[model samples]
Target: MASKQAQRLAARQQLQQRMAVKAEEERRKRTVLWSIGGVAALVALVLVAWGAVTVFGADDDEAGASDPDVAELVDEAEAASDRCADVEPSGEGALGTPTEGLTDGRPAQDVYLECLQMSTPDASATESCMYTSVDGTSPTPLSVQPAAGTQKMTIVTNLGTITAEIDTAGAPCTAGSFTYLAKEGYFDGQQCHRLTTESIWVLQCGDPDARGAIEAGTPEMAGAGSPGYQYEEENLPVEAEANYPAGTIAMANAGAGTTGSQFFIVYEDTSLPADYTVLGQVTSGLDIVEQVAAAGVM
Candidate 1:
């Protein structure tokens, strides 16, 4: 009897010890799982906060005009749009400036956002409308009264109320550059030196003086006095379907990706592959272009 009792006690003690070991292991596993989840949640929160800061923080001037490739692209598009102002819209032109207030949660709102996002200045970057918003209550809906600032307007030579509707929507950077330089009087009294009627149809202006017909325009006389900054092309209208008829005010360049203080006016519609920036068409004073052309490099 004693031996049997001792054997039973030993068996019970072994089983209890085994159960304790198993329980300890399970507790450790639960603790480890909880700790891992906490770390993951913390990481996710940090990322979300960082993204918000980047989106809503104060705009950086350097970053605002950042992206050299984009600036060059804007220059080309603006120039091309200018030269092709009278051209009709084949489809779309360059990619438009991205507006960020469009990511609403609703399907239609999201679709509208997608369309705007996909909207290109020309058919080259064609995209279809994905959604439409009827109620305007989409998650990414723009504010009814958002802050769209009035860009500064600068007239280089007071071409007598040279009225123009600045295209603030299409090329903000380029527009801003022009306005900034103009307000600072960078192009005051600059002469229209070059008039090419063959491959191009424009009377290029912005030479400080038009004394002689220099073969290659010098930097001092070329469109060189702007803010020394360039912009990428945005929201270019199709050349074939543009509103700028003949006698349109436009921008000119020396070669590809070269546009600055110089401006031009189209007298005839000539087909050229080179781009000219169609900033704003002369609403009232197209006669000025004709007069300057008649005067020729004086």
Candidate 2:
């Protein structure tokens, strides 16, 4: 009876040892699976973070590419002659000297004889007109007035070339300003910053301090650059329905007599109150503007 009892005890001890080994093996297997899952999750998060950085980095690069440096344009401006220094008006109806209170919005007498009359066959029948400024300051004084006739200018751009005709008959002052600025290479290396497709179908350009070129969150300083002077409006439409037709090139201004270097090209018949100076008409390259407009703003 003692031998049988001892044999039973040995059998029970062997069974318990086997069960302890099996439990340890199962615990190790579960630990290996948990470690693999953790590693895989970390790899997935890394991939997602890399993808986000790549996508956002690409977008920032594209924006930088589109916005050209304003410093380049400023360098061009500095190379030109300082036409505003010691300036004096020239031509038949030029001001004898610079005067104050000219750009005061309200109608004032032509103090400096800056007002001119268009010469006609009957010289006595010429109507008097004034060249007003925005801040009561003249732009680099045009030493000479533009000759009377349809002056032609070729606007070369990266996209295309635009040919325009400055109508000296209708807008002599505005034409003269453009002629002077073009000669000084002011418009070179400049891009059209603003494009409005709806309500106003036009492409505005000629801001030396192109605010668009600056990165986002930077203060904008566009549409504020000038040739150190301003001019009055000319050739405003008489009839309300006399809209600026497609291909019409006109000046952009802050208000009355505030014409600056910025100008807009009408891609479609746009109805705007005749507040802006009618600079000229685009003879060619209207299609280029239309194509740009079709692509829409990026």
Candidate 3:
């Protein structure tokens, strides 16, 4: 009897020790998991906060645009003209700048580099509805406010593909017009007619009759035509030093409500008045544009 009791006690002690060890391991695992989760949550929160600040800047007044510190930051950002990110041009263009007819006397390379620095791959998620009156001058979308979602506008060129996230919420009419035209193959095979190398850094395109001007175009005979209609302007950027940042795809208009099929992609921070409608922003393959811009107007 004594021997049996001693044996039972030994076994029970061993089992208890093993159970304790297992419990300790589980605790450590839980701690590790909790720590990881906490870190992830913190990162997510920080991103959300940063995004909120960025979007809130949509309204200058609300975003403290007049604040001295905020003004300084904006000034710093604009004056940081030397800030240029390195870009590798794999497309069919020169990788260097100072090409003939590219600069309006300024360091054009700085402009191109700054534009590259501001390029990003983020897409907007704001839901927009553009309800406006049209001149009926050209073919328009069947429904101005079709749905509430963003559209992906892809332009495939010999250099590469440049994709933009259409700001349907902000420029519904413009987006609708572009979408309709693209679906009808309107922009297909059209030449990117005009390449501006002066005050504005942009490549203008979408002119169906952009031929002949492919290599040689007069100032007035470029991408300057409508589908057959015109619409009211909507969603102008708020007042700012550089209202149009790089990677911005905006409607190229002669004046208000003159938006045609012709559009321009801003390759630098331009100080133009907020007279044009921001179509959307480039999300990918902006390097194609950078390469061309670097190669200069040809």
User: Which candidate has the top score in lDDT?
Assistant: 3
Please provide TM-scores, in order, for all candidate models, with all chains considered together. Answer: 0.43, 0.53, 0.54
Query: Candidates ranked by TM-score, best first?
Result: 3, 2, 1
- Per lDDT, what order, best first? 3, 2, 1
**Residue 38 displacement in candidate 3 (angstroms):** 60
- Clash count of each predicted structure: 29, 1, 5
Clashing pairs in 3: 128-169, 137-228, 137-229, 138-228, 138-229
lDDT winner between candidates 2 and 3: 3
Report the candidate with higher lDDT, 1 versus 2: 2
lDDT of 3: 0.59
What's the lDDT for candidate 2?
0.58
